[model samples]
Target: MDGTVDITMPAELEGTRAVVRSWLKSVGETVRRDEPLVELETDKVTTEVPAPADGVLLEILLERDAEAEPGALLGRLGARAAEPAAPTAEPEVCSRQSAAPAPPALEQVREHRLSPAVRRAVGQHGVDISVIRGTGRDGRITRADVDALVAARASAPASGSRIVPHDRMRRLIADNMLASVTTAPHVTAVFEADFSAIIAHRAKHKAAYERDGVSLTYTAYIVAACVAAMRAVPVINSRWHADHLEIFEDVNIGIGTALGDKGLVVPIVHRAQELSLQAIAARLHDLTARARSGQLKAADMKDGSFTISNHGVSGSLVATPIIIQQPQSAILGVGKLEKRVVVREVGGVDTIQIRPMAFVSLTIDHRVVDGHQTNAWLTAFVQALESFGD
Candidate 1:
C-alpha cells in the first residue's frame, strides 16, 4: 500500500483556533515517527503536531501564521516515492476516458504522547519545537523549555514599537479576572494584624525547620491560620453555586504564584486543613517551587476552595478588593510585614511599643458571603496569628 498520511491537529485542542506558528519539517523533508512536524499556538499553550509515521512531508496545506481548527489538515506525508507505471499502448483519447478508483482518505489521529502541561504550553506560545533545546529524557520537550523560551523572548529588547501578543495563560487570566468581577459583587474588609507572635514562633523554630529541610516562611503561618479560620467559618471555604452554596469538607488552599510577565498560577495544597504547621510549610514550599519552575501538574491547580495572594513577597503594601477566584467565596491578601508603633496599656499607663505587623485583606463574593461573615473570618485569621504558639 502506498503509505500516505494526513497530519491533523490534536483533539485536546478542540474548540480552539490555533495559528500555524512554524513548520519544523519542510516539504520533501523526512520526518521520523513521533518527531515534531509543526508547531501550533493556541491561547492556552503552544505544542507541536508530531508525525504519525516515518515518512517524507509531501504537501503543506496550512502555512505559518495561518489559522486552523482542530482536526484541520495541516499537511500530508508519503511513506515512499510513487513507482512509475508501465507505458500504456491505448490511444490518448481512450486513456482520458478510463475510469479509475480515487485514493482512500487519510485517517485522522490525535497526538497522545504530550503531557497536559506541555500541551498547554505548546498551544499557548506556538513555539518552534525544533528551536527548543529539550532537557527531558529521550530529548522530549517539557514545560520548562517553553517557559525558558518565553522568558528569553520577554527579556529581549525590541528595536522599535511593537505589539506583543498575549499567550494563552495571559488571555485566560484576563478572561477569568473579568468574569470574576462581573459575576460577583466584591467587597473587601481590611484588618491590621500583629504578626509578632507568628514571627517569634518562626524565629524560635527556624533552626529545627531548617534542620528538617523546610524553610518556615510567614506565608506558611498565614496558610495555617487560614485553615483554622476556614474550619471556624466554613462559609469562607465554600463556593457559590447557581442555586445554592457548596461548602467543601476539605480545605484546598490555592497559593498564587506570580510568573513575572507570564501571569499568575494558583497551585493548590490539597486537604490543607488536615495537615500540621510543619507539613503545611513543606507542602507550600514544594508547590511554590514547582509552580515557578513550570512543573505543576493539572491536578496541582484544581479543586481550590480558597485562594491566597501573598502580594507582600513583592513589597506590595496592600491590595484592596482583590478579585475573588471564581466559584470560591473569598481570597486572602497579605501585605508586607514591617515593624510599626502601637499604643499599649501597661499597669493602667499608656505605653508605646513597636510590633511586627501586616495588613490583611479579605475580598469576598457578596453573593455568597456577607459583611458580618467576612469580618468574622478576618477576626479568626488575625487571632490565630496573634496567639500563635509553637
Candidate 2:
C-alpha cells in the first residue's frame, strides 16, 4: 500500500516569504523520514524543509528560486515500497562501443550524497568537486562548504573596483534597517559608564569561569545590568503599537552579532530577567558560537523585546542614534572601554584618578520612551556596572 504526503512550508516561516533556494531531491529519488528535502532562504535565515516520512519523491511543485509562503505545498512524497519487484522482462545486450559513458565517480557520489541545495550550488559555481573538501558528516559536501568556496572565489576579483552582489541575508538586513530608521523617531541619550568595578570583578573571577569552560566577558555584566534597568524602567523594554505601548513582563535581550559582510544577526536570550550572571554568560557564549557557525534556529532570532549592540568588541568608541530594532522601543549600544583621568573628592580632599570607562548610548523610539525614562534606564544600567561586588 502507498500513501502520499504533502510537504508544506513551516508555520514559523509565515511572514518571511522564503524562496526555494534549492531542492535536495529529484522525482523518483528515495527519501528518508526527517531527511531534508529542500533549502529555503528567507531574508533572515536559511533553513531546510525535511521529508514527512520514508518515501520516494513524487513531484516538485515549486522548483529552485520559486517564492513560497507559509503552508504552501512544496512537493509530494510517495509511501515506501513493501518489497522488491521481480524483473518483468529480460535486458537486451549492447556492444561496449554503443553503450553510453558512465558518469564520473565524483558525480555519482554527489548525486547520492549531496542535498539538492548543495548539488545546485556545486553546479552553479562550476566547482571542481574533485578538489573540494567536505566538512559534513561522513565527508559529505554541504551547502555551507560550497558557499564558502564561492565566497573565496569572489573575494579577489580583478584587483579593481567591482560590484559585489548582496546575498539574500544582506539585502534583508538592509531593508529592515531602512524600515526601522524610517519608522521610528530615533532619540539617542549618551552616558559615560564607569566599568572599574566590573573590570575588577571579572579579573578576579575570570580564572574560575575559565575552569568551568565559559569565558566571562563584559557583555554578560551589561546584559545583567540591562535586565535590572528594564525592571526599573519597564517602558524601555516595550513594543510600540500605533494605538498603544505594550510592555512585556519578561526581558528578552537580543544580542547583536556581526557576520562580517554577511550583516548581523541578533539571537535572543529569552526571559533574561530571571538568569544569573553566570547563566547569562553561558547562554550568551552558546548563542554566539552557534550564530557564527550558522547553527542558530529560527526560534533563536524571535520575540526580542530589547536589544544590546556591544560595538565595543570591535573598538567602536560611540555610535549615536543606532536605529532601534523594529517594534522594540529601544536599543543600547556600548562603546569601547578605555582608561581616563577623572577628578574625585576623597575624604574632603580633591583627588585625580585614572578609571576605566565606557560610553553607553540608548537609542529609543520617541513615541514610546520619553527622555526621563531613558535616563532612568541608563542610570540603573550604569549603577549595576559600577556596583558590581555589592
Candidate 3:
C-alpha cells in the first residue's frame, strides 16, 4: 500500500506562511522525509518547510512568491502515477475577434499579461497605474515606466543600479531595503563616544568571559547599551502606522551579519532588553557564526524592533546606516573601534592620551522619530557605555 502522505508548513517556526523565498525541490523530484522542500519568508525571516514523507513530489500547487496560509497544501507527495483523464465538459472556445471591452467592462476582467517584475513592483508600491502616463509603444506600460513614476519629482538624484541577478535572500533584502528607503523619511544622527570605559570593561572581563564560552566583545556592551538607550528613548522603538504611532515595549535587536559574496543577513535577538550582557554576547556569537555558515533559521531574522549594524567589524570608523522600516523606527550603526590620541584634563592639567573610541550613527524615520529624540538616545547610549563597570 502507498504510504500515508501530506505536506505541512513548518511548525513552531516563525513565518510559515507560503510566501516563497526559495524552492528546494522541483516537480517529480523524489524527496526524503524531513528534507527541506521549500523555503518561506516572513518580513524579517526565512525558513524552509520540510517534506512530510519520503515520496515522489507529484504536484506543486503554488509557485514562488505565492502567498499561502499555514497548514495550506503547498504540493502533493505520492508515488508517480499515470496522467488522469481530462475534464468531460465540452471545451468552451472563444472567438479571437471579440470586441474590446469598455473601461468599466475591462475593470472586471483580470489582466494576466503583466510580467513578474512589473507585478511585484506594482503590488509592492500599491500603485494605481491608470493615472500614470505611459511612454511605451502603443502606450503599453513598462517596468521602467513604473519605476520612473515611483521616483517622480524627487530633488535628490535617483539611485542607479545595473541589473544583476540576485538569489532569493538578496532579492528579499533588495525589496525590503528599497521599501524602507522609499517609505521612510530617514534622518541620521551621528555621535562620537569615548570608548575608554568600554575598553577597560572588556579588558577586565575578556579572559574570564572567554573561559565561560563567551567572546566578551564590544557588541555585547553595545547591545546592553542599546537596550538601555531604547528604554530611555521609547520613540526609537516605534513605527509609524496609517492612523497612529505603534510603540514596541520589548526590544528585539537585529544584528546585521555580512554573508560574504551573497549579501547580508540581520538575525534578530528577541528581547535583547531581557538578556544579560553575557547572554547577549553568547547569542550574538552563536548567531553570527551560524549566519556566516548558512545555518540560521527564519525565526532568527524575525520581529525586530531595532537593528544594529556592526560595520566597524571591517574597520569602518563611522557609517550612516539605513533603517529597516516596518515595525522598527531606527537602526544604529557601530563604527570601527580603535585607539586614538585626544586631549584630556587630568587633575586640572591638560594632557594628550590614547583612548579607544568608536563612532555611532542612528538613522531614524523622521515621520516617527525626531532628531532631538534620536540624539538624546545616542547620548544615553554613550552614557550607558561610559557607566559599564570594569
Candidate 4:
C-alpha cells in the first residue's frame, strides 16, 4: 500500500491567525501535482495550498472556516493511485454547485482573462459573462462589471440596504483590534518634527538610490530615526508584562501597510537598528510590494518590538492614540509633511520662512512606560530627523 500525501499549511506563515476559506476540489476528484487545492486566508493575505502529487483527493480532514496553522493537515491525497477510496468525511459544500447557467462558448474562453475579482465572483455565483455588459474603456471587462452582474442576480436587499458578511481577514483584524484596546492602556504624546535636513538628504540621494533599484522614501528615514531614538530610550522598544517589562536588544520595526477595504498589515523590517538607511529602504520596499501583492511570508511580519504608522500618506494630518500592536510597548505615527511658516534667525536678523514640517506622535502602553519616557523617545526621534545631514 502506498503512503498518503498530506496536504498541509506551509510553516512560514506569520503574525496573524489563518483559516481555511474554501477548497478547490472535492474529495474523489482527480487533481494534478502542484495544482491549487485550497484557499487559506490570513489576517493580511489570502493564499493557496498546492497538491503534493498527481492523485485523487481522498480525504477532507478540515473544512472551510477552520483555523489552520503551520504543519496543520487540511486533507490527504492518494499518491499515484488510479483508484482512491471515498472520503471518510466531507462537508455539505462539497456537493454544492453554482446556481448560474453555463457561459456562452466565447465567454468560456474569456474566463481565463478576467480580473481576480471577476474570476472570484464568476466562480462563486456561476456568473455568465455573456450577460454582464462591460463598463470599462475599449469594451474591456472590469471588476465592477462582474459585481453588477452578481448584484443583479440577487433579490433586492431589504430597506435598500445590502448585507455584506465579514470575511475571515476582517474578523481577525476586528478581534485583534478589540483585544489590543482592552488589554493595553494607550496614551499618546504629540510632537512636531522639522524635516528640512532629511528632505535635503533625500533630494540629494533619492535618484542614486533609484538607479540602484531601491525606492528611497521618507518612511525609510523615519525608520532610521526611530532606531536612533530607540538607542536614546530603549524602553520604547519593549513589551508590557504583569510581572516585569521585557526590553528587546533587537529593534525590529513593523510599519503599518494599509490594504484599503481589506484592512491593514504590518510587515516588520527585522533588526532595523542594525540596517543602514538604504538597507532599510530596500527591505521596506520589498516588504511593502509583497504586502500589496499578497506575497509576504509569516516571517516578514513577525518579531516586532515597535511599530510605525505613516498615516500621512493617506492625507491625514494627525491621528492620535493610534492603536499599538499588542506585545509592543509603543507605536509611532508620522503625519503629513507640508510647508509651514516659521521664524528663523540669519545674520542676527529674525525672518519668516517656509519649512517642511510634520507632526510625529508616539503612543505608548502605560503599563510599559510613563509620559516622561514617551516624550523622551519622541524628542530623540524628532532630533534624529531634524538633525540629519547636519
Which candidate achieves the best TM-score against the true structure?
2
User: Which prediction has more favorable lDDT, 1 or 3?
Assistant: 1
| Cα lDDT, model 3, residue 116 | 46
Error of 1 at 354 (Å): 1.0
Candidate 4, residues 1-390: lDDT per residue as tens digits? 267888888777633468876676778777888877776777766666788888888999888778886678899998555567779896567435657666667766666646454577678888778876543322345454565566655755657676544555678888888989999999999999889999899999999999999999999999999999999999898887789888999999999999776578899999988899999999999999988766776778878889999999998989988998987988899999999999989999999999998999999889888999999999999999988892
Q: Write the per-residue lDDT of candidate 2 for residues 220-274, one digit (tens) a residue.
A: 9999999989888888888888798789998999999997766788999999999
lDDT of 4: 0.82
Off by over 4 Å in 1: 1-160
Q: What TM-score does candidate 4 reach?
A: 0.82
User: What are the lDDT figures for the candidates, one per model?
Assistant: 0.80, 0.85, 0.74, 0.82
Q: lDDT (0-100) at residue 45 of candidate 1?
A: 42
lDDT of 3 by residue, 334-384 (tens): 888888888999999999998888888999888887778989999999999
**What TM-scores do the predictions have?**
0.67, 0.83, 0.72, 0.82
lDDT of 2 at 129: 73
Give me candidate 1's TM-score against the actual structure: 0.67
Candidate 2 lDDT score at position 297: 72
All-Cα superposition RMSD per candidate: 13.7, 6.7, 15.5, 9.1
Clashing pairs in 4: 14-298
Better of 3 and 4 by lDDT: 4
